[model samples]
Target: MSMGTQGAGAGLTRPAPATRAALLVLLVGAACLLLGPRLPWLVEWPAGWTVPATDWVGAALEWLLGGIKPVARGFSEMLRYPMDWADAALAVTPWPLVIGLVTALGWAIGGAPMAALGAVGLGFVLASGYWVQSMNTLALVAVSVPLALVLGMGIGILANEVPRLRGPVQVLLDVMQTVPTFAYLTPLLLLFGFGPVVGLIASAIYAAPPMARNVLLGLERVDSQIKEAAIMSGGSRLQQLFQVEIPSAGTQIMVGVNQCLMAALSMVIIAAVIGGFDDIGWEVLLTMRKAQFGQSLLAGLVIVAFAVIIDRMSAALASERNRQDQRVTAGLVLLAVAVTALFWRSLPDPAGFTLLAPVAEAVDRGLGAFTAANGATLDAIKNGAMFYGLLPLRIGLDDAVLEFTWGFQWTPAMSLALYALAAAGGLVLAFAGRATAGALLVIAVGILETGVANLAWPFVLTGAAALAWLAQGRKLALIVTLLLLTILLSGLFPRALLSLYLSGAAVFACALFGGAIGLVCAVSPLAWRMMRPICDMLQTIPLFVFLIPVLMFFQIGEFSAFLAICAYAIVPMIRYTRHGLVSTPTEMLEAATASGATAWQTMRDVRAPYAAPTILLGLNQTILYAFAMLVIAALIGTTGLGQSIYLALGQADVGLGISAGAAMAILALIADRLVQGFAEERRRALGL
Candidate 1:
């Protein structure tokens, strides 16, 4: 039987057994939650008498190396030696010759524009006196990215081969990706002892998951016919993977590589806090600490430059790889070897080049003057804004929400009614075709178990009103309704309120801003051109680097925190918007123009409607990004689930953290499901 038939048969046989299993699971979960506090015996803990071998080994190494300082010093020296050589080579080599070589290498691997962009970014770094640090950063990325790619690919292949392992592997990857960067630092520090190695290892771990997931997705998407053909030819698993699967999934795998590279670069900057290395990240940290605003900004620019170069190079490589006929592997190899040889031959002494010091000093002076001039004014503004503006706004909003929910008779009932309405809507939507009875039963159980049945009448009316208003192009009305509903629900249950409002606001704001920027960039060719590199930099530059600057400028508040959230969230919006707009059929555009439609009219009436599904997908991404940033934003201080999660990490409260994280995941799932439903409807309507 066909897979579809098998699936149908399984579905027919599944519901009763699955329902029973689910009930049992819920009972077990309830038991655990209720008795967990009193069941000391159920908790697992390491014996106090037991010694960890890794810790012992680390201690012995620490003793032999005379502690972390000497070990760090030795590692630094080892890495620095090559850097010194590169600096010497840079000094001796004529700028033109080096530029030419870099350009040539780029052209060989990618093309002329990529080579040109690479040269410009490199030259900019050199002139800005950040060449050495940039190179050091590059070296670490160079090592880590490939390692991540290889490891990710291996895992991805295994996941594809072993069908049973897929779900578990995906879950593990999700956890790895979501867990705070700081939480992993302690364990990594214990193992790698704080240096480039630790940073590289951490970056690799952070970067690999997406690649593995993407690779698996790509592999799974390959045509069954192609696989069958390969199998019929008596191809072994390894041979089929190499000859058919990899080749067919080449473009997707390359995309995974690009993601890996971007992820690694981002992590490398964050790793600086754990004493990764004396690269651009270290410089930015140092500059910030010393109140060297100009220096910090300049360091940020250099980092941005490095990010841009790597992003462009990888994108170009991916593109080149996509066009397999144009790729000249032999030529690239020759060019790389020649450049390396020439660079080595023209090496200079370390003492001769004091290029970076002058730049650093100048930055210090400029920053000092700026700070001195604006110190009091800036401080006063910052304090006033935080105290009078933000504090009052947040407090009033929270108070108003609380009062409205508690003081009003109808509001609480309305909120409960909305929940029931949503549940009913979900059941109707999900089961309208064939599984109506099962869906209704599931919804009934969910409502009853959750004690939402009491509020069902109010929730149904309120939710229906809200959703109806939304369907009629009344977004603001919908938003207001949602906010009110959230407030009332939160008042009823503060914990639930915290999770809903904070997560909802973050996602909404992120999608709004990201979508707006993306729309602008997508429409304007010049803006799109300018934004490409900036977007590339944003994508590749470490999240920590972005966080540092925002923290420095705005300090810790909802405003600063939101700004950081928006920065990361905006990427997909721009990317998807641009993609959607560009992918709109040229023939349609011409036809619209021929029909005497203005550009704005064409875009509004044709392009936008056509692109709605893709744009919605971007919004979905924005939600994910916003949710991800919520956890990260805790670093800058905010009291919510994120803060709780961070505190849990600090105290090694894994259970608490996991529970909170699950709550976050549920919020994410709700958004995902809602957006996915909308996207699916749009696609069907559009015949996509």
Candidate 2:
């Protein structure tokens, strides 16, 4: 009893690091945000402050590529074996037989409905006379997916096994995922030049990061008890991983495969743009270029069809209970379908029959009908959007920024002075026993040294501090501060800031609309059931495809690009909002109701707060999707970092592309960090 009391007493006497850190940094951060801008040098990086950082990265990539060329060639040659095999097997096979095989496989995986959908999709492609082109796409996928799976799986395992490397690897993955897919073409073409293999390599690279992330998540999320049990059983390290962790992670890893497949499909068209894949993407491009809107629209649908079938199968493979059953059903269904097809083998030749003519006519007519019916209203909306919405929006944006920062042209001396102020603040905090807070100030100073601090540093610092304070996330505030500061010297800070504000606006707009749908879904079962699939379909459409409908309605401009971003990004907001609200614990709601709360009151007090964290995650996805579409939006001519990438691509300047892409990534990471910080705080409050 005496010792226990002593221990408690000692614990009570110990100082809280977080409290000290928060208080110290808060005072210094505020000073920096307020007075530092007036003293321009105080917030800028030091004179001639080049970091000598990027040279190493370029050298590393060059060295790695040079060193691996022979090995890549040998390994890639081996991978071509599967492509060759699939090619030969399907080469002489009738279109009906191929369609039958895929339909049966889909049925085996997801049952009759999915099978029928697969059959329709495959048959439509054949009937549209695009079977050969799609087959070529498949051959590309067949080779790329396997190679990506192996590399992704291996990298994921390595990340899991080595704790020290995980952060760096994950950072790399995050950057890789955020980089515009078009940007990858720069480095890849420089190495492999223009060939199927180059496209194959690029697609594989794009697909691998998602897979690695999923695998890493799968491994990390495994039950600690299960791992302990494996250890107790005297299993070897390899055996424990293979037998326990890998199996447990199976569902998530397979989900990664599903994502990887979709990413590959998305890239197939884009890859074709870069002279890589010459399949359906090429067909769609050629048609679209020639103003063959009907054929182009049909071709785009063909790509979506392929995506749906592959995604369904991959999802079914990921679910443990259905895996075995699917295989069994697939075999039997395929056999029957093959037999049935043999009876009407003559239908395989599209030259004689016009199976898709009706579909083409319907699409063409439907598009015309929509335009004819709504032309005047659409015109009003378009003009209003162009002049009132877009033009006026940017006009007010720079005005909304702090008056002090607008004409701020900072110098090296001013930047060094800001570091001095920060140092002084840290010293005071440290002397007051707030070492962690002081440490953050020191880190923030380092960020200032990098020279990016001059671009909206006051607003950025204020925003971070406020959010961190709201979340009780002092540590995150420091980390995010350092991250934003590191890019200060890049000359991209203003553009990145512009991109973020645009994304923020789009996300806000999406949340308003998405939240309404989510609220309806929350209250009604039928609405939930109907809206879920619509959201899924919205998400499955590729990045640029979102632009097609937007361009058709609004024409190419800021409004059009913003609309495209919203259309593509809103699905996550809708999905996550619905899920978060619907999945709220029934007991919590009951308790709220019992506390003399009305239905609306209970929802506001209980469900909404609990759901906020999840909705934020959805918002995070929305932001990322917005950025992805934001980059693609450059195709229609818009301003910001994405437009920078567009201009850079035009000059074939790989360095500029990389810099602009990295700046966008930095912007994304900042948003991601803020959301994560708040989510953690929410969970802690709930004690979850």
Candidate 3:
């Protein structure tokens, strides 16, 4: 009786942690809001607070570069050597030989149909009077793809073993993958200066992470059954890893390489923006700037064609059937292309080729008329977005956040109280398992603290790192913190929130449309067969390509941005969900069937739970994809951190650009962590 009474008394005295946390958050938030308005200093970032940290970073980079100037030059020169050789060689190389070479590669890798497409694509570029430029882009991709794959493999291999580093590495990769191409110029400029080398360096850096990530995933997924068999056969660690694990993981690695190839090609244009290689990317940008829609469309189509050819070939090579046989043939074809590219100067041109010139022109003309025909409709759509969506979103979210952070009107004591309250709230969140929220709250408090708050950022970062180490055993809390910090510092926290507000709506939209399509197709094998190729094709098309038509139809507004993001990011959602459903273990389905479950019940109870992680992965990819396009869509008037990055890049303001990059990175990380965390937990419970 005494023990029971004591237990009851203890239970009454100690409330649930979640309940306590919620109560504290509510009380603190209420107090801050009520008193915060009166406290100017507490509400807004005060003046005279600044960090020369960027300058320090620049200096450090300069010092490092200067120390390795000689080696840097050598590396730069070595990379340029092949590019220069290809340019000169292609200028004189016979069109027939060039066409035949690509055709052979396509034939060897993907069979006759792909070979024919390759021929058409190569011939079209040659005849269109852009052979030289096309070749330049091609060579860049050829070289960069291999380098990225190799480097990615090396790094992924090393990183996978360092358990503590895995989280931080992933955070870095996620950030890098989505960062705007222009932002990288800051670091590359410091290292390689301006030229094709700059583009090469940037392309490799940008493309490697995906390959690395895929490599890691591939290795982790290698079947323990196969590995154990190798061990029983007395295979050494290195032998088993090389002869067994690597071979088994070929498909994933190939997927990474294919993505790397596409990314490298996409960056060619961006790199040209800042004096890299003179290729299709530059021409595409130039024609667009001149408003020559037909010509720009032509160039864009050519890029798409090239992307298609590469994607198809890579996919065929990675397929289960004839994998070993395909490898040797593919290798030979690639070697032939590279070797032929080397002798470009020796081979005479077949006097102004006869291939895609006419087709390209017709397509260009058709696209021009298409856009023109819809001009009125597009204009109306644009107006609707700007007036209806953009303005309201900006005013309600952006203005509201900024106003609170700025302390629009408040007395000195009120400001101090508001600042103190924000600090306390942030502190509580930090300790209460919502590190992201805590960091944002504290940063708000520090902004209110202004001059001194700027200095406090370092400590905030330290605290986040320390806290992460304590809680998660050294994942990437610092990077997660920095991401939010960047958004705050870039003066875009308000806009960033608004960006998320829009992205959230967009994601929900994708969930509905994409999820429906995927689920419907998954239920029918024949429908899945048809849709799978279509999805794969759509996945190959770059986000920028989607923007051209979206901008035309939507007429350059927030809605255009939203539409583009949806189309670009929705593929992953549909693809992942369908793949998960289709790939569900047969045994589970049988068990559910044995239990007298209907199809829907099996999906909900058996397949859905089994496939949740994959679907969540799709969700994660969708968010990242949406954010990736966020910067590009800014050109159409989407207001947010993306716009800030664009403006900063234009002004050459490194600090502003980096901050925006960091903010976007954190936003992505937060969404990723949320979905990934839940998915991981579910998978663990399901023993998957």
Candidate 4:
């Protein structure tokens, strides 16, 4: 062929943009690894170039908060009345009456099953002998939830009413979502001093975003025809909004309420770390510190009970199903009153109840015996996971591979061979028409060898740009690069990498394990039936409660933290995976069957690709959940940004707290955008 013909042929064979981006990322990573030893700067940022962003942030916030101290103190005082009222009322209420009231409310909303759940759940809480402590926690929730609801509703309505504010409001909500719950306590801690009011205000602030977001969503989704009808009926703007739009958006608002309740409860428990409350959260912390595992477990269970009851009851409000007879509710309430009157003098203090003490003791004894017998096995499991998985991922194989841990030292020659094999595999894959996959494989190999925390700044930035470009476009790529560069310059990049490593590890495990469980559940109704309630329970339980079981079995370490994160984060993966797989259109299955595809073949070729976007969404949720749990997991022994945030709380260093939180939020926000972009791309590709 002539020279012109050959050039045209080469042009036709050039890779697509995504493929080129992937290859660029791979090359940059490999070059960083090859040059890192000779150019030490490639592997680590210089201290001389670092900005004291933490100190600066602290100084600015201190100035701002100091200015508002008087107003905040007055506000705090005003808020205390409701808090105190709630506490006193709950503290003085008879335990039986509380249970009956909850059961009656449950019956009114959801009928027999909900009523039974409420009764049984409260019964368990009452029997656990933490009634007073539980009530204290509930009081905090009671006061904070109302505050959160009102604040969230106002924000949501304001955003909805003004078109100009919607974007900013959404951005605020998104940022708030990534900020860890504990991070909210630090500045509030300074403002409120050491008291339960800090927890109340912290929780109120932490829980408000969900409500605002949901309310805005609900309002936005209201049928336009309804608004038109209201207008045509000569209703004023406020009348239309209150009487029509808001009422029409009730379901979504109720969803917000449910989420608000959960957030308040979760934050309330976490806020006990500040040592100003005698709530059940405090009880759990106190017992855990004393090594009283049985009592801690009981307290944790009590929290779970409250969570389930609150979650279920609030959730019922959102459903369109017919409610149970109101007379039954009235009867139950009357019965409670009658019983209280009859037994007023003889009733024992709810605090003295210990009906479940023996049960807790048995659990403790059984746990002890099992651990004693399986101590070696448990140690082996933990050691194996650390040596083979986490350690290599943390500090890289070159450093982590040692005679004491991996049984053999990794040598330079072995590294050469590993690179050689990886290059060979990549070449083969490229030749097989999978250039993008091949490039990603090479990049993964480089990361595994170099470790996340040690990655060169240029390489990390390039990789993020490439991924963002592929996921969305130049705009997102620019945004991600800038945000990451800020973290890098701020000197928090190392800790951010550590956070990335742990959350990334947990997400990978969840994607694997939860995906498998989801697949199984998709294939079997019975499996889903069995797993559904467990998933619900896991989701309902507060993030703090997850530490109890893992701490019992594994003790306080990275492993315990890892397990807790996985347990909490895995639910979404499972739920989304099952829903995506099961919700595949019947027509697609029929077509596959007509084409003589086997069940496994249809699943792989038809179902898997169709479910990719949904599965990606699940992965996104899993990532966010893992990051959220990562902060709480710091209480045990996990390191990284989580530890920084927790430490900042202890020292009351608002600067470090806010800066570390911003860094963590940066990572989460980037991950969220990247995953969502990928999911959107998949949806467009599938024409969904």
Candidate 5:
């Protein structure tokens, strides 16, 4: 019995598999660092070693596209008819009638609030002097949304009906969601040869996944008893699906509709980059390029107005509340008709209405004045962040710590001192039984000293594998290793690193600030009240519009892009963090109180641990958001795979665009998997 007890104790004292992996990773990193100076290949990938994967991808796609170009063009031509009809219908419709129709529809879908939203939102659009441009955009959305709905619904139904297809369908959707918006434009541009057709198709493709996902969710959530009842009622599978299951899932399907509308609208605007349509998005782009900041803001607002109206109206459909009276809707429509008919001859063209144009001009002048006045201050902030923060992360201390920038040149001796300090701290942590954290601290210091872009390939792989292994098990670690290896072989590894660096920097900034704000919001209801609307507005606005405000203050640069990414990505962090913290169970709080815990102590010891998985998921979302915005930021001024994708879009290089997109997607997938793994582990530990 004594010998058995000793064996059990010894077994319990052994380090976990994760700890062992971390130690192995640390050893690999240390070896790489020590030998790196003598081995150039350790610091950078050798050119001779990279496969010409991009060229091969290009060749394969060119051949494939050559075979399918005729069919694709035929389909494009087929799609053109509805797009043209929709465009002409909206174009010819009188502005008043259109506004009235939207208001009435809003009433039918929601109530007075939605009706008012429709009226005021459309009123702003009409007043912005971009009414004609807005019409062009609306027409594109009008046609593309239905196409997306049908395609997405069909996919969802098929996936639900066929179990084997579900996994593949889901995987495809994940890829679609992670791939940057601009990446879709390249191959489509090649297929369609530069037209609104490309935007139409791209918007449809981009917008479909949300609907498909929601449809699948809705169908799956239908009560099993309901399914049995339908079967007992002698309903055919088709009848059950279409008449019973679908109607039963109306709320979720409506939610899908809302997402589909928002996505289509956002994509249509982004597709303006292709420049075949005279939509509001194109107007914003045109004015922005001309340095007409005021006009750009106005056009962007028009897009925003449209987004809000569409979002609110569709969202209301998912609500259980009864819609407003039909008589009110009819009265509004009649009023619009009467007004249009009575003033038909004297009515001003909507395009000629420049009520907001003066405001726009003033805004432009004000922005100019503000920038001019604060030019020195802005420059200082920008330079300070770049020199102290982003530059170091990108290029490392050895390169970035220059006499002019950091006021001291980094020497080899300083590097040794940094490593020594890290080692000491790591040892202390290890002694405290936090071996993994200690090892991670040393690895982080090494990364900071070497810089992300200059990281040795083997070190990066080992670190990633360690994280994955700790997060889940061997399978995830191996998967991450293989995926990263593909990027390494693609010749796009350097650009991938740059992309990783920028997105990582933005995510770090977001997590730090966003977590603090969320904590404060959790502690104070008034703070949450103030923040809630701001979060809602930020989320409501499309990703493209985010660039405008950042660009207005900072102009075009990496700093501007970073700020844009943070602004867009920070919402989820704030929301999820607050939610996780505030959602601590009442019993747990009571238990802490009974144990004589103070409010702060309860929060620190009880709330935070329970919220760990939730917070990690929030961080996961922030990471993805950062990557999505990273590509859009490329339009202003950014380097990395985003730039490659954007350049490929312009050049119509299908190979480079797809390959770079895949690399970006791979990076995002890796981050997503690792975070999710950790969150899953936490959940399992809590038996949740």
Candidate 6:
């Protein structure tokens, strides 16, 4: 009579009482999903309700504040006096003074270019009429980033040291990373009363996960042999950590710092919504809300400039540290002092200037002009394109996809068929091995349960394209196929599939383009010299900031989003491809040359194939970068799983958001497994 008995009667025996309890839990969850939303009591709040304890606390705080009112007011006034002086000093400072300071600091740390870049970026922000707001933004970042870094490093170190805690910490970090930023606002608002402090706290929490994960990665990667050697030398724990682990892991930790800074920057705009002080985030948010496109765009640009300059400077410093360049160290110190002086001298007096008013006016005019000139055009284009172009194509493609899925008997039942085939194929390919049967089976059943069999054709086509490109070395065919599939998938399911395709296409295109560019740069000494700074900038620059200028030029759409994706995705491809080409065993290259092979022949037969697996791994990373960009792309009007996830955040639809996020994870997992499998096979073939 029980649920377990009913389940058993249906030939699916519940495992045990504990299992039955879990099943009951699942049933209750389902019931909640079905009924909770429509329940009146769930939606409504009791009227005129006040908690006595909360009132008592408020009264107590008020009474305490009243008693210390004079002291509190005096303290606030005292703080303001110095702030006033600093502001006055900053506002009257000559531009050259600031620039010189920045240049000097840069020269002391890493040298000329980095110092110059920092000075120039900061100057631009100030000159472009954002000095005060910029300072405010900088203040928040200065506070939050360090906190995030310390916490992340501490947690990471703890997790790494204790093996048992690693799994749970990782899981928590994963959930935190995937959870929408908006959800934190509600709880934070309740606790911190919607101020810059709350915003900083939220930003720190959001950013810390990546830093922690990266720290753990770096620590774990430290050579065990080196640690043992340190131990043998009678090194204390602190000594070992500082000398052995920390130094070795410095590069990754710096990378984590880069990630943390970028994440903090992302919160700037959002923080405005929750009473962020200093008007930088506020300006962007207000401009956007007020339809001040140009102003909003400009504010976003300022943020990007800051991000880029800091990125370049930090990267140079980190790299220079690795090389142990005293020049870099001295340059950084000088640069820092210069920056400090500039900031100190250029700080604005809050009392004298009406900063926000000018900003608001400029933004209003810009928005008005933009609306007058391009608003109608954009609307018309969007409407016509949606109706005449996108809608029709989407409809036809959707129909075709549906037909393909339903028409072939093998397709609707493809999950089962694929599993059976993969299992059989694995057995045959491995000489009757079943090493991965369980995994394959679980994947297949999961796909079936999720109803993704409806997308079988495109999936298979993509797989085929990957295989063909890998096996036959048909570059043009591969490119064409990839683009075609991307377009088709984009049309068929624009909401979910388009973003995926765009990401893939962007990665592929950027890889190809970057590879060519890298080769050209590498071939010419002068060009290589010219490109070194650029590459450094690219590596150090935050990925999120890449979206800002892109949005400026292209506006919100697929193009801007794709451009952002390409900018971030191309870096690894360029680096790896160049490394692979340069590192292709010297003996092999010599033998090929000795055998009278042409340069082209040597490259095609020797270098290309030799670098295939490494290049594939780069491609894998590019795909991941692309996928990661999807959520960011939503700011530019992408409607897909990304949009779904975004909406879920806005509405507090955790279940819906998580489910959609799962779909993305599944997509990543499938691509990862397939490419990795192919890579492994190729590596084995090459005896690598």
Using Cα atoms with residue i matched to residue i, what is each candidate's TM-score against the true structure?
Answer: 0.63, 0.78, 0.75, 0.98, 0.97, 0.61
Report lDDT (CA) for all predictions: 0.63, 0.72, 0.68, 0.91, 0.91, 0.60
lDDT of candidate model 4 versus the reference: 0.91
Worst 10 residues of 4 by lDDT: 1-10
Q: List the residue pairs that clash in candidate 5.
A: none
Stretch of 10 with least lDDT, candidate 1: 1-10
Off by over 4 Å in 3: 1-33, 40-44, 47-56, 62-70, 127-129, 160-175, 217-252, 323-376, 397-492, 524-527, 582-610, 685-687
On residues 517-608, what C-alpha lDDT tens digit does candidate 4 reach at each position? 99999999999999999999999999998999888888999988999999999999999999999989999999999999999999999999
Ranking by lDDT: 4, 5, 2, 3, 1, 6
Tens-place lDDT per residue, model 6, 295-404, is: 66667667778778666566565565423455665665566566657677565543334444466577668656775788777667545544433332333222223433
Q: Which stretches of candidate 5 lie over 4 Å from their true place?
A: 1-12
| Candidate 2 backbone collisions, by pair | 41-414, 41-415, 42-414, 42-418, 44-415, 451-488, 451-489, 452-488, 452-489
TM-score (C-alpha) between model 4 and the true structure: 0.98
Model 3 C-alpha lDDT per residue in residues 438-505, reported as the tens digit of each score? 54575445433332212223343444444343333345555556655654454555566667766766
Between prediction 3 and prediction 5, the one with superior lDDT is 5
Backbone Cα, N, C clashes tallied per candidate: 7, 9, 8, 0, 0, 18
State model 1's lDDT.
Answer: 0.63
Which is the winner by TM-score between candidate 2 and candidate 3? 2
lDDT value for model 6: 0.60
Cα deviation at 470, candidate 1, in Å, is: 14
State the lDDT of candidate 5 residue by residue for 1-688, as single tens digits. Answer: 1111122364455556666777788898888888888987886778898998989988998888888999999999999999999999998888999999998888888888888999999999999888899989998898899999999999999999999999999989989999999999988888887888899999999999999999999999999999999999998999999989999988999999999999999999999999657888888888877878888888889888998898888888887878468899899999999988998888899989989989998998999899999999999999999999999999999999999888889999999999999999988888887887787799889889989998889988988998898888889989999999999988888999999999999999999999999999999999999999899888889888988888888889999999999999999999999999999999999999999999999889999999999999999999999999999999889999999999999898899999999999999999999999999999998788
Please report how far candidate 4 places residue 621 from its true position, in Å. Answer: 0.4
- Minimum summed lDDT over a 10-residue window in model 2 is located at 1-10
Q: What's the residue-level lDDT of 472 in candidate 6?
A: 42
Task: Give the winner by lDDT: 3 or 6.
Answer: 3
lDDT score, candidate 3, position 405: 45
